[model samples]
Target: MGTIDQTTYTLTCPQCLQTEKKKVLDKGSNYGGSHWQEGVDFSEFDVAWAGGGTSEPVITTAVCKKCNVPPSIVSSYS
Candidate 1:
């Protein structure tokens, strides 16, 4: 086991276009050669709301400081 190299990646949400800072663990970008995923994976869920729903996918991985976002935090920039 080794340490993880984490980086602050400022990304904007695709749907809401909200800017949020996400900590990404680049195992491939490690000092040595750690080829591991971000220890975490963003779960996907079907987007459906009032009236009807769109075919688009609503993935929970953004922390909108304002509003118009999912009820969750901690995610990677897709």
Candidate 2:
């Protein structure tokens, strides 16, 4: 199986000024490989994947639990 990296970040809601913690997975060399099939838990936030097809996928946006407003990614770390 290929290695999977996990990254955590904070997302802030623009409408309600709320902050939430989120996690994302980096398939790295596994990219399109099917070594893993587990679902990621996003808790109380909504997330979207970006930059697929030609590049690595990244979590770029999240939905705020407070007002249901989608927020931009603030910062992330492995």
Candidate 3:
């Protein structure tokens, strides 16, 4: 096992455009290691992931707490 780090993710609600930040565990080496692993904490949000054949886990559904909507995505850093 590798060291765990913290990563901040920004999410937005598609319905009301509300934004929120969440910190999750980022595993593996950050300094050019061959292996890297990370995951999204589903307990933090009402979210779902894409299934099958993909190289990585993709966020398929994310619900916003304020708007009760399910169109949230990991926002790009500014």
Candidate number of the best lDDT: 2
Lowest summed lDDT across 10 adjacent residues in model 3 is found at 49-58
Give per-residue CA lDDT, model 3, range 13-69, as digits (tens): 667777667544434455744322334554435766553222334567678666677
Q: Please list the Cα RMSD from the true structure of every candidate, rounded to 1 decimal place.
A: 11.6, 4.8, 5.2
Q: What does the lDDT come to for candidate 2? A: 0.59
TM-score of each: 0.28, 0.47, 0.45
Where does model 1 exceed 4 Å of error? 13-17, 27-33, 38-78
Please count the clashing residue pairs in each candidate, in the order shown: 0, 0, 0
Model 2 residue 76 CA deviation (Å) reads 2.6
Ten-residue stretch with the least lDDT total in model 1: 49-58
Candidate 2 at 35: error in angstroms?
7.7
Tens digit of per-residue lDDT, candidate 1, span 1-78? 353445444445455555545344434333555543322322332223221121212233444444445533333434
Model 2: per-residue lDDT, tens digit, 1-78? 344665566767788776767554545364465232232446656776665433445666668676787876665556
Winning candidate number (TM-score): 2
TM-score of 2: 0.47
Candidate 2 or 1, higher TM-score: 2
The clash tally of candidate 1 reads: 0
